[model samples]
Target: MANQSKIKVCVAGATGWAGSELAKAIAVSGELELVAAISRQHAGKSLNEVLDIAGTKIPVFATIEEALTVPCDVLVEYTKPGVAKHHILTAIAKGVNVVVGTSGLSDEDYEEIGIKAAAHQQSVLAVGNFAISVVLLNKFAEMAARYMSNWEIIDYASAGKIDAPSGSARELAYRLSQVKKQELQVSMEHTQGVKETRGADINGTRVHSLRLPGFVISLEAIFGMPDEKLTLKHEAGNSSKPYVTGAFLAIKKVGSFTGLKRGLDSVID
Candidate 1:
C-alpha cells in the first residue's frame, strides 16, 4: 500500500489494554495511520504521552464528537458495551466505517446497527474474538453440530469480565443453533435441579459461563454421543497479539461492506 493510500484510523478507548495495543499496531503499520485517540480519562494528553509512542503527536479527545473533527477513514472501537452502540451509530452517521471489538452486545443490537449503517452507506464489522483459531473453532463447531445431537457451550473468562456469557460463546451458540437443534437428554421443563444449574438457553443450546482468577479467556464446545464425547476448546493467552492481525483485516475489508457484519470468519475467504 502506498503512503498516501494508508487508512487513517481513530481509536476509541485508546488508553485501555486492548486499545493501546491496537493504537500501537496501527501506528507501526504502513497500511494504517493513527490520526486520533479517544479516551475521556486521557483527554488533553498527546498520544505520545498516553500511548508512549515517542515523537508522535496525535491528540486525545474526550468524546467521539470531538474526535470526528479529525479526518479518518475508519473508527476502531474497544470500549464497553454501554457506550459501543452510541459510538458505532455516531461514526456511521458521520460517514465513517467502523470495526467494533467490544463484546456484550446482543444480536438485536447488531441488527439495529446494520439498518443504520445501510441507511448511512457505511459499514460496521463486529467480532466476538479476533483470534484466527477462534474463527476456526466456530467453523468446526458448526460442522460438528450437523452430526452431533447434543452439545453445550462453556465460556471461561477472568473475574473482571462483566458479561455473563462471553461473546465468543454466544456467537458459537447462535451459529450452532442455526445449523442444528440440540437434542437435550432431559428437557428443561422436566429437569429436577435448579433451573439455573442447566445454564442459559441460547436458541436451543445451553451456554455455561465461568469467571474466575488465573483464567484469561477460553471457550469449549462439547458434543455428546451414545458411546463417546467430543470437546473442542481454544484458550487465549494474556497478550493481545492474536487479535491485531484479524482486526487489521477487518479494517481493510469493512469498506467493502454496506452494513454490519459479525464474526472474523465473515472476512476470511
Candidate 2:
C-alpha cells in the first residue's frame, strides 16, 4: 500500500445513515479506495448488496477486528459513543489512523485517545459534527470568546438522542475555552432560583442541553458584552448531506498529523 495514489479506508458504520452516504462517496472517489466495511447487521454481505453501489463488492465485517485484517491507511468511525472509543483505540493500536464522526465522547475520552495515538505515532481526528456550518459556528464562537468573556452554550438535539450537549456544542465549548476563560458575573451557586437551570460548567463555560422533538442538531453560543450581545449558531436538517464534505475533508487530512486532534478547524488551519 506504500506509495499508493489512493488512500485505503475502512468504514465502521457502513450501513448507517451518514456512514452509508460516505461509503457511497468512497465507492466512486478516485482518491480513496474502500477496502473493507463494518456493519454488524450487514456482515457476510457485500457492500453492493447493502449500499446498492455498483462495482463495489467489498466484504462487510461485523467488527473492526475483522475489518482491519485487510490492511488500510485510515478507519472512519461513525458509530455510537459506547463502542466508538474502543474502535478508535483498537484502530490506533493496530497502526491505523482514524477519523471520528461519532459524538458523546467526553474530554477524558479524548485525553486517553491522545496519549495512545501519540505513543503509537498514529493520527486520530475527532470531529463532533462535520457540517461546514458547524465548523464556521465554532470558529465564530472562538473569535467571540477572545474578547467577550460572558458567553454560554445551548445544545439542542433530537428527543431520542441519548447524549446531552451534542458534539457540536461540546466542541464549541472546548474551542471557546481555548481562547479565554468565560467570565461569570453571577456564579451558579448564588443563583436565586434552581441552580440546575444555569447549565453545566464545561471548561469554564456554562452549557445548557435541550433534548426535544423536531431538532436534528443545533448549537448556539450567546456572548454578551456590557452594551451588546452576539449570538453565533448552527443548525442541521434531517438530511445528513451537510456532513459529507467536511468528513471527506477530514479523511483526506487525518493522516497528515500523528496524534489525536479535536474539531475540523484544527486541521483546517
Q: What tens digits encode model 2's per-residue C-alpha lDDT throughout 46-86? A: 99888888884789999889999999999999888889999
Name the 10 consecutive residues with the lowest summed lDDT in model 1: 47-56
Query: Distance from true position, residue 121, model 2, in Å?
Result: 0.7
Q: Please, what's the RMSD in Å of model 2? A: 1.7
Each model's lDDT:
0.89, 0.89
After superposition, candidate 1 runs with Cα above 4 Å error: none
Superposed on all Cα atoms, the candidates' RMSDs to the truth, in angstroms, are 1.4, 1.7
Candidate 1, TM-score vs. the true structure?
Answer: 0.96
